[model samples]
Target: MQSRGRYHRTVLLVLVRTVWIAVCAAVLVVSGIAWSTVSTISNGVERSFAIPEDAPRSSSGRNILIMGLTTRLDLHGEPLPDDVLRRMQAGESDRGGYNANTLILLHIPASGPAIAMSVPRDNLVPLSSGGEGKIKEAYGRAKVAEEERLQAAGQHDKRTLERAGREAGRRAQVQTVATFLNQPIDHLVEISLIGFFHIAEGLGGVDVCLKNATKDPLSGADFPAGRQHLDAGQSLSFVRQRHGLPNGDLDRTKRQQAFLSAVARRLKGADVSAMQAMIDMAKQDVVLDSRFDLADFARNVPTEVRFETLPVEGGARVDGLDVNKVDPEKVRKKVTELAKEPPPPPSNDGIPCID
Candidate 1:
């Protein structure tokens, strides 16, 4: 039982961290907050140079990449507090490395609902770090290489090394995804797994629906069919259950989409004080590109936001690693087609049901 519990917690941490792209956006500038509060929150957020000051702007809209690192470590590479680790049910600092397990691109067009595209982490593609590998590896690969270079250069402080290495990682990750999807990244929002738990806690909890009664020992998800509310831990379990699903990681992607949808709905009716508190929590976990304007985004954010996964040809193995096979041209064309469609109508539906 002890061994099983540890394995469960380990998988729980890995999978749950793969979502929460929504948390960064949804928590940062929910529509009703005061401008002063939004400005303060924006200023308090840690900034990154992943997107360059003179990077080419998107002609039609702004594209923001929200990268969620699988690392169990915090932004500064320190282990999370014991209390936080206990609450997250995650393992010690060694469990997850520096992979960007979750990559979501949000395109806020000049005049319509924003579209969020989720890119599966295991998609095999040419990485900016070197040759072909999982898209998720681009971050860690660049990070390690930069750290090694920095070590040779005599910058030996641990935190300083980690910070510089992470900046390289972020830049590589942003460029890799932009090349893959053929889009310009105007800004970036980076977070670690713990941010998911913190955002959920701020919401007080969330409501999710599953299509069938299910139990997954690996992810620690055991819930009955139909609409059910979950506390922060259970909410993590909710998005983490992919082992028993027919589509595996693909289904997990949909679960993440539904979760963000539910978050958006909840925020619409959330108390002003609660929203402010959530923003406060977010500032601790999120890092945004220096150029992102939170106040303008708060005022102009669309009422309807749509989520979809980038098309993958299928699954394949390369060098003994399982990866999603994606056709780059097909992906770019698909994105172009999606861009041409009119914004989707607002969903009056409540919590979305998922398998």
Candidate 2:
């Protein structure tokens, strides 16, 4: 009983953390408010030039890359305030690097339902940095290299260097995923670990259902089986715990997908005022491509979205690191098949039961 409970809790955390970026986008696109209002709120939101200007876009639909970084630092690469850090329990800023731990490719066509597909972080593939490695490493590797190159060229300003390094990281990550999936990236949304925490807080709390009652001390998750509401901190814990899960990280990934579906359902029912308030709280933590127009994107979005995890052949070790082995051709084919299907009907009631 304890073992199964842990597995469900782990899955919940993984799903929730990975899909925070999608939820952020949903807030912008589903707020059901005036474009001018969205534009006003987004006035000073950070923008990235990761996607190239001349990149070919899908004439049929839009593909958005939602990435979650492992870093605990603020977007500016500075340590978070002590109080905020304490609230997050994310530890000091030095703990994590810029690895893109969560990657979800969301495809929204000119018609039909939107599809949000989660890419496992440990997938071994050819990277934009020139050699093959885990897909998640593309960001940090490029960032470090760019920072070094800049320092060699006599740049000493910490903020300037940090910004430049991160830009390089973003470019590498975008290119890597695009090439892997054989899809053009129409937009990019990047958020850090703290972004996840802020998003959960902004939502007030999220409704989640677990199949088994569980206790995970590491994640501070202790909840009974069945449907329930989790506050910001508890929500984070529910999505972060993988230690006691039966399938470990894989279960967590499944949870992330389920969590996203639940969030989308919640957003669909939210009033414009509530969504606007959440967007205001989240804008600081989000980094969208400069070309992205929230108003325009929101106009075409369908109320229904389906979430899935791309199929992986299995796992193997490369350079002593565990990685998911995936066939690129197979992945592309799967995506094509999914894009052709009609979307499922929107649901507003029961939480997505996860275990």
Candidate 3:
């Protein structure tokens, strides 16, 4: 017969294991939502996407590009409803175009820490087809180019044409970022405003930390120093606000990272209800490029994902706009160094006080 102490310890162990399993299940629920459904086209254009066989990969490295688009329009370039616009708290009106406001290149090394490096939207770079402009504008330009090319080819199917244009846009955006960083990209995950809102709502609320009292009138973000929970509206504000941030766009980039950190943690334990809410919301707002297999990626998730910003000298005046000046080679070297660094100490329940 087992001793009383041993029996109690065994019972405690079982309870702990049960709770851990439940949490893992909850976290995976949101991840289970497929990206293929995230972008739907009624016009029925069946296209397949995959990385080239000779594309770079290593036994220890994986690079993925995760971008956030700035637009109030659906994938078809149509505007969202007033009610959703209000809930999203997106600062600007829907002008019916797209620009990548957030561009993060994530490096998940097979045997080391995962790094999420941010490339500011204002990073001025040469487009693949030639000419210099803010990197973010590539999406809109590519979409227009694809549409015109298809039209000239006598393919007048509007739905089919529009989806093709967006796919081309995705390809362009990924290439631009990858080339800028001098890195090879294997996958792309782009999330829209509505999907993000639903995701925040689905998770109940995401928790974020502030280092100092902050209020950005533009993004409409107001928060006190320390940790706090944010609803969908406020969470959007938290990541989008840049006007009052100390380093302007760079600080906003950091905020985006902190928010994602919390989201990464929340995703691990988000209940079925929360996951379903995001799934429902995503039906109209998320796009996972055809090459990525979400199920496989989720199952082989890294032990940790850390966020950082690419090295930059600072902002400079260019074409009457403040743009971040970055050395592509230097940035690439920095990331190569990052791959070998150890992961930071275990974060709080989520990342803490990321001010």
lDDT per residue (tens digit) for residues 1-355 in model 1: 6554333322221112212335323333322344454466667778888888877778888787888787778888998888887777656777778898778888777886667788988998899877999999999999999999999998899999999999999999999998898888888888887876776776777888889888888767789999988878776766666788878888888877777666655654555454555665566777888887765665555545577788899999898988999999998887877765634644545566788
Q: Ten-residue segment with the worst summed lDDT in candidate 3?
A: 16-25
Query: Between the candidate structures 2 and 3, which one is better when assessed by TM-score?
Result: 2
Tens digits of per-residue lDDT for model 3, 29-51: 22232223322221122222534
The most accurate candidate by lDDT is 1
Least accurate stretch of 10 residues (summed lDDT) in model 1?
Answer: 10-19
lDDT of residue 292 for candidate 3: 54
Deviation from native of the Cα of residue 24 in model 3, angstroms: 12
lDDT of each: 0.74, 0.73, 0.65
Task: Give the local distance difference test score of model 3.
Answer: 0.65
- State how far residue 92 of model 2 sits from its true place (Å): 2.0
Which runs of model 1 end up more than 4 angstroms from their true locations? 1-33, 342-348
